[model samples]
Target chain A: MFAEVLTIGDELLTGHTVDSNSAFIASKLTEQGYWVRRITTVGDDVEEIKAVVGEILARKPEVLVISGGLGPTHDDVTMLAVAEALGRKLVLCEKCLERIKAFYEKLYSEGYIDDPSLNEGRKKMAYLPEGAEPLENTGGAAPGAFIEHKGVKIFVLPGMPREMKAMLEKEVLPRLGRRKFLQRKFLAEITDESKLAPILREALERFNVRIHSSPKGFGKYIGLIIFAEDEGELEKTVEYLESRGIRLEEA
Target chain B: MFAEVLTIGDELLTGHTVDSNSAFIASKLTEQGYWVRRITTVGDDVEEIKAVVGEILARKPEVLVISGGLGPTHDDVTMLAVAEALGRKLVLCEKCLERIKAFYEKLYSEGYIDDPSLNEGRKKMAYLPEGAEPLENTGGAAPGAFIEHKGVKIFVLPGMPREMKAMLEKEVLPRLGRRKFLQRKFLAEITDESKLAPILREALERFNVRIHSSPKGFGKYIGLIIFAEDEGELEKTVEYLESRGIRLEEA
Candidate 1:
């Protein structure tokens, strides 16, 4: 199945931060046998997030993993925007509120902050789109949300890499089931680049593998990635290419 | 003015490569005073690229910078897709073809490749949309394209960072004019995270500066970025935040 990744933050748009979150999510989704079709990034504006989320839903990807904009700040409005996009209301999760309270209290005890109380901005983290399951965040204060709408599994994650990774490993991967897609990287040596194209096209026609090739440099080698469901299929594709006078080396 | 960035590559979607090109483009565009509203990454499929390009145009952004898929491979179809998106035809750019031939000859002379003659895949890089200006790629073989369609300054760039950066600096930024936006970073030392929201909100309302803040850690500091047109506006906003008892340090 195909999936999409959405990352939200004003800092991302302004070029203050490089968006490694979407790449991490895409890699994990790929490992789980999902084809990540697109990755979208938007600013912190509610309207922008809403418009993008709606558009993604209209495309109907099987899974959507959104990261960023879930924090105790004014511009962290991803939850509200996501709720609006799903035609759902923002509702408070008391359990999430309690967890947030304990999180801050532990931080205060460790002398990280002055206050342990939940203010309006902090309490805002407890609200999730109605009917969404609260995904636990082991590394941060804001709890993530998981919702299944219109056959699409939507996951809302935090901006921080540590928190997002924890939630994705603990919460997201488990829900995606046990299927896996194997991807192998290779450097294909071919002196004439034009002749390589027809061979690649033939490989696609004769095999059940997806091949993606890009020139490594202005050289004789092209980077090739073959994705297959099993090792035998991957091996057969490699053998077929090698028999066609293409030298392949693991990369 | 507002802008959008679209990066095309299958490797990006597969997470085999992280997209640092968009961030570099965003930072450069921001410095030129364009609010980058969105960054979209799609695979090397022509239809997907066309769909995303159409969507970005419908938003009416003043500038659109698309990177990647400008190579001489079968999947490098960004220029063709972009031409289709704008309802234009892909016509041969004679100058670009000459440059491509020269580039291959140079590569052959340097012993980088076995053959210097142009092939079908290499020839494809010389085509551009009808009425579009070809941007020189000093670091690669495929030349970029610059098109102005319905008030949008659309720039198609190569995926290679060196080539894209050189083309962007020499070709894209000059066309975007000289309007510059200044951005300053600070670490705002605030003990209570929630209390800093209203102060930031007030800073935005009272000044022409745009403020973005995110927690540095579960600690007493928050990362802040202030964007403005001049040094005076930026200084005034920083001073205003200080007056509200928020400690600021250059970061």
Candidate 2:
């Protein structure tokens, strides 16, 4: 399966927050045998979010994971954007409202909140685009959401790392079981990668494995991250490279 | 000016590499007064790279910063993709060849390489898309390239953090120059942000400063990142929030 991740936040766009959400989703999706084709990030602008949703949807990834902007803030506009993009009406999810109320009630009990009342902004978290199912946010107030648009599974998760992680494990993971990736890493101590290029190119054409090389300064070492699902073929490639005087550190 | 960043590498998409390159470029662009519109990342696929290049170019961001995939390996396909997208030919530049030769010669003198001869793979780095200028790499072998397309300045830098940073500072920054961004961060300890909602909406409406609020799990605190180019507007917004029982920490 192919997947795409759209992360929304000005914090992420401005570098106030490094987008660990996309990486986390990508890694998780990769483990489930879903090739995360592209990861797109935009600021907390409804129009940009809506436009990206349209674009990524056109690309037609089987699964789409969107993180951030599901907060009580004015900047949180993912729901509105998704609604507009999917031509769905923004409606209140009663279950989500109950969850938000319970969250505030717990805060009230713990003396974290002055009142258990759900104010307008807090209540807004309960609103989801039409036909959206509220995914429980065990770690926070705003409930995460999931919707199916044109056969694409769209998951809207919170921006908070803690909350996003918990919900992803509970809600998204089971939907995508698991597919292990077998990658063989190698660090070749080479004086010049140019010397090994012929071997690298030949190996790439000859084997099922895909080879990637990162040049270390002074041509002393080239870090190679090689990917091959077939263990036997990978071993043969390793042996072949080693036989050609490429000192490979099978990491 | 509008800006966008594209960081290319399979390592990045597959989660083996965390894309710090986009964030670094985004931050730099933000500081230079460019509204970094969006950041898109793609794996080391030629078609993917070409498609994104076409899309982002059509978006017409005045400045587009591209990092990664400029390596001596077979996976290094960004150059080829860019050339094809722009209808440019891949041609070897003599100047780039001289630099490559010098780099290898220095390595040979230092006894880092067994041979100083520039193989076909090493020479391949000199073959840039037509009309592309080599941005001298102070740290590595592959020279970074720069091209101007339809008034958009496209900077292609190496993926290695060290090389990308060096070239960005030396080659790309001067072209962009600098633009200052004025921002104010505040921590508002509040029982309910919903209570402050009216004030925040009012503040957002009345002031030129763009207000962004981040909900801290409980209704205990809300982190705010506000942006204002006008000094007076920033002060007015700050004062108005303080007057409304919003305990503000000028972070």
Q: State every prediction's TM-score relative to the real structure.
A: 0.96, 0.92
Runs of candidate 1 exceeding 4 Å displacement: A192-194, A229-236, B229-236
Best by lDDT: 1
Place model 2 in a CAPRI quality band.
Answer: medium
> Which residue pairs come into collision in candidate 1?
none
| Window of ten residues with lowest summed lDDT in model 2 chain B | B176-185
lDDT of 1: 0.92
**lDDT for each of the candidates?**
0.92, 0.85
Instruction: Please give, for residues B23-94, the per-residue lDDT of candidate 2 as tens digits.
Output: 888877777777788999998889999999999999998999999887766778889899998889999989
Against the true structure, candidate 2 reaches a TM-score of: 0.92
TM-score, chain B, each candidate: 0.95, 0.90
